[model samples]
Target: METDFQTVEQAKSNIQALLKGIVGTRTVAIRDALDQVLAADVLSPIHVPAHDNSAMDGYAFNGAAINPAGMTQLALVGTAYAGRKYEGTVKSGECIRIMTGAVMPEGCDTVVVQENVTVQGDQIHFAPGAVKAGDNRRLKGEDLTQGKPALRAGRILRPADLGLLASLGIPEIQVMRKLRVAFFSTGDELRSLGQVLDEGCVYDSNRYTLYGMLTRLRFVDLIDMGVVHDSPESLEAAMNNAADQADVIITSGGVSVGEADFTKDVMQKLGSVNFWKIAMRPGRPMAFGHITNPNTGNAAFLFGLPGNPVAVMVTFYAFVRDALFKLAGANPTAVPLVKAQLASNVRKRPGRTEFQRVRLERQGSTTVAHLTGAQGSGILRSMSESDGIMVLAHDLGDLQAGSEVEVLPFEGLI
Candidate 1:
């Protein structure tokens, strides 16, 4: 393990270089494939809209029949509704009353909206240049061409993707199998809910926080290993057990340097683990690499995060979240950032990257970021009250009030 701290970008790149998406895949119905990664590209079996159709409730006629400088009149011979077509062909002097989505009559290519025509008995009259040739006509294969790629491999299925598949008449699709992740919190001073707290112990909030975040990722299969006591034997047993069952293992609290930090020792002994002191605030001590169960020959990726509640969340968002998405065979998208003016001056150094909790306030016409008091790693309430995290980049110095900054909103990510 290198004692020198790694930059945030270096740590992310190193982690990604070592990972490959899971290999296993299965076919499932479209309804059940939500948030699942596609194992294969989906091709459209047929053209969408399959035929040339009318896009509005109007009168369909050939454009050449209309007189350019004067009112044009055509006899209305028949009507066409959606899902039904007019049987007869339309001549140059004839038109068909067509509803939205109705198939255009044979020999007719343009549609003048109903509002643009005046009806007199069986005759409909419209002014010249009402609509050009092919106006308001939906052409065959307009939305999707037949035998074309509709969805590509490695794409995560969303609600809109499901609708697209249904439109292509695809009932089921091939997707990567769910990734199993085992997680637990470490520290002898931590206690679970409903347990009696000792004089020196506090209730374990890391596991609950981890649970909420993990649950939001529908593609992940969670294995909550609960809290493991701070002991060499206990840590070893849990690590080996988790490796045998999960593809990835996450632990909070034991990666930091302390007397009871036996997690680092056990991880290094079992696998090729790299302990990294990242150049970032809220989360600095982290461990990344693979751990194996020697007896079963089963190996799993591991993320050893810091002990503080806020640090766990920040590290997970900054590092582990995308790592999990990539390992599960999905092409993850980066979360977007919005610019906001700072509400007050911020005291920041020039080396390490910082993520400060800030409440976004809309004052007058501008949105400003207000600091949520002291930004300590143990302060969880600040995170709860904030709208998003203001990311202060590495090498950025102190900023005066009203200076613009980038913010990562908590709308999609908690």
Candidate 2:
């Protein structure tokens, strides 16, 4: 059914409400869990350090030995290297030479960094202010306590998370099964990469761009269904096939109210789909809903993005990206936005929100965003040349130079 034009926030909320988590899980080696959503809470099996240890190459001794008014000297008994233990206890007025990560000897509650002390034969001397109690000592269970939850479910595992798991001797982890996504470009004028371009036809760049974006997510099994023509038979067949195999089906073009486009018809015939005109620049026309195969009773979530190159990217990042994350059983993650001064004047209307392509640079102490030439939807180079997107809000009008605006960087997503 046709829905009236809605604001970006409203559209996003609607899409989010319709999403359902995909079920299934699998166990994979920790090395293979990067970018995969964690399926279960991982409780640490043992203390991270297991025992009190030295954080530096130094001497371990009781802090009480330090005299507040003068230098304190302590006799060095023995040495303790990493993986090696000093069996004997440290007595008063005595210290043990300890390497980094070495177990702290009994009766020692502090460490004097090697550089802070002067060695004189069997004695180590340091000023009263050279070290403090409990300094340079890594206490047991400081990093992660035994039987505590180290990592929670629904987190997208990153490099640091893998290191945490490895520190606890965890060899494998439970992760949600990757979401399957089938996508294709629509329009008879769309041509494949190797095919010769006709008079009016252009190469289908949407498919390639979509492929790149999906690949970076790393949690999706991508199926490039090639280019589906603008016909009921072709569109319906493609949608059904995609629905049968994938958890989400994405298509570019054929969504707008064009006389020749049959994408809307095929979508309605298959299942419930809502056509929406979001109040946003670059991408406005969009279709969202679920497509169910009548014969097989299989279904998949749908996202019909705009045909323009930049619009496809903008819409995907603004809407589809988060939806896909939710559908994949990932925890909600907020994309960071930083304020930057505009290097030049920008013309913006008040009603619809705008995503202007901008290249950021350091202007003295303040970061500034310069417009990437023309802001045309068909100009894909604008996106390539830009470092981030400057979000001009719906209530904001034309902005002058040096005005502060929020910019969403392309750091993690690119």
Candidate 3:
């Protein structure tokens, strides 16, 4: 009945080390690559803005013709629009009317914005100090150069990356394959939705929340195996079935030190699973390891999260989230943390880290964090009303009002 305790940092390191192998890769169209991790470096095939072009709709002229101390007037030669070029050369004392994105004409090195110039007949007049040499011009290869790396491997593709690839005339790109994740809740007291709930039983909400969290990742193939009973036969059957189809298996209950729970025994019998008491509040008991499929002998990573609604989310966000990203071939990314002043006093222990749900308020230029109602492991409403979690470190004892602490917002991942 003894528990093996590990600090938060140590547990994270252990979990990451277990999932070091990268997933396989596949080719996908740029449009279909959003949120997928890049498998190889993307090199630009050609220079962006292949020719020197105008960045503004203005007059293009030789910069050397401008008088330094007084106004200068130049005769307008011709007009140039985007996709159209002025074949004639611009000499001193001559200018060409140009539109935005138009290729710079021959011998033109500067552009005076139209608002800064006055036109009378064929003459355009502008102050000498209104424009400078090489003003309002986009040079060739300024945004991206040919044969240079535009995006590195292991980068998660965003919407803008697709546009960047389209700009480079790349229709498709290489990206890591989607991760396969199978999850289920365990407990005889749990029931699926639309089922009549008997005494001492409740409809399972863990699977729904897990589904939402996995769906937001956008690159996970989720297998919702419903709820498994707390019996040796039932738990082992579920694990074997999940291991055959998934790279990772997530279970929401039966990880705590309870006599009725058979998940720990079944996991240990099937693979090299470890049950640990992590030094963290709300999510203390967890099981992590690799489980082998008895049918096919293939192995899959296992994450046994606590049953409490908030604990399941917190443990997944703090540990399993990053591990899955690494296994899916994504570059290491840290969750963004921002410092905020505490609106009230907080009490804590010295040995365990605590994650308190809080609401963020903007008081002038400072961000202030206030607790969201009650801080309980089973309180699902607190998470819904909270903007983020205020992390109280292990070495920290207590915090006074107006003290600053780190908070991880639920912006990028909800």
Q: Using Cα atoms with residue i matched to residue i, what is each candidate's TM-score against the true structure? A: 0.96, 0.97, 0.95
RMSD of each: 1.9, 1.9, 2.0
RMSD of 2: 1.9
Q: Distance from true position, residue 21, model 2, in Å?
A: 1.2
**Deviating ranges (above 4 Å) for candidate 2:** 1-3, 259-261
The numbered model that scores best in TM-score is 2
CA-lDDT, candidates in order: 0.91, 0.92, 0.90
Compose the digit string of candidate 3's lDDT tens values, residues 1-414. 124678889999999877865568889988899998999999999999788999999999999898889998999999989997678888889999999999998799899999999999999999979899899999999999999999999898999999999999999999988999999999999999999999999889999989998987877789999999989999999999999989999999888887364667799989999898999988999999999987799889999999999999899888989988888888877878988999999998888889999999999999999999889999999999999989899788989999999998988572
Q: How many backbone clashes does candidate 3 have?
A: 0
lDDT for residue 400 in candidate 2, whole number 0-100? 98
Q: Write the per-residue lDDT of candidate 1 for residues 270-355, one digit (tens) a residue.
A: 89999989989989999999999888889999999999999998999899999999999888767889789998999998788899
Q: Judge candidate 1 at residue 173 and give its lDDT.
A: 95
Q: Model 3 off-target regions past 4 Å?
A: 1-4, 259-261
Candidate 1: residue pairs that collide: none
Per-residue C-alpha lDDT of model 2 across residues 364-393, encoded as one tens digit per residue: 899999999999999999999999889998
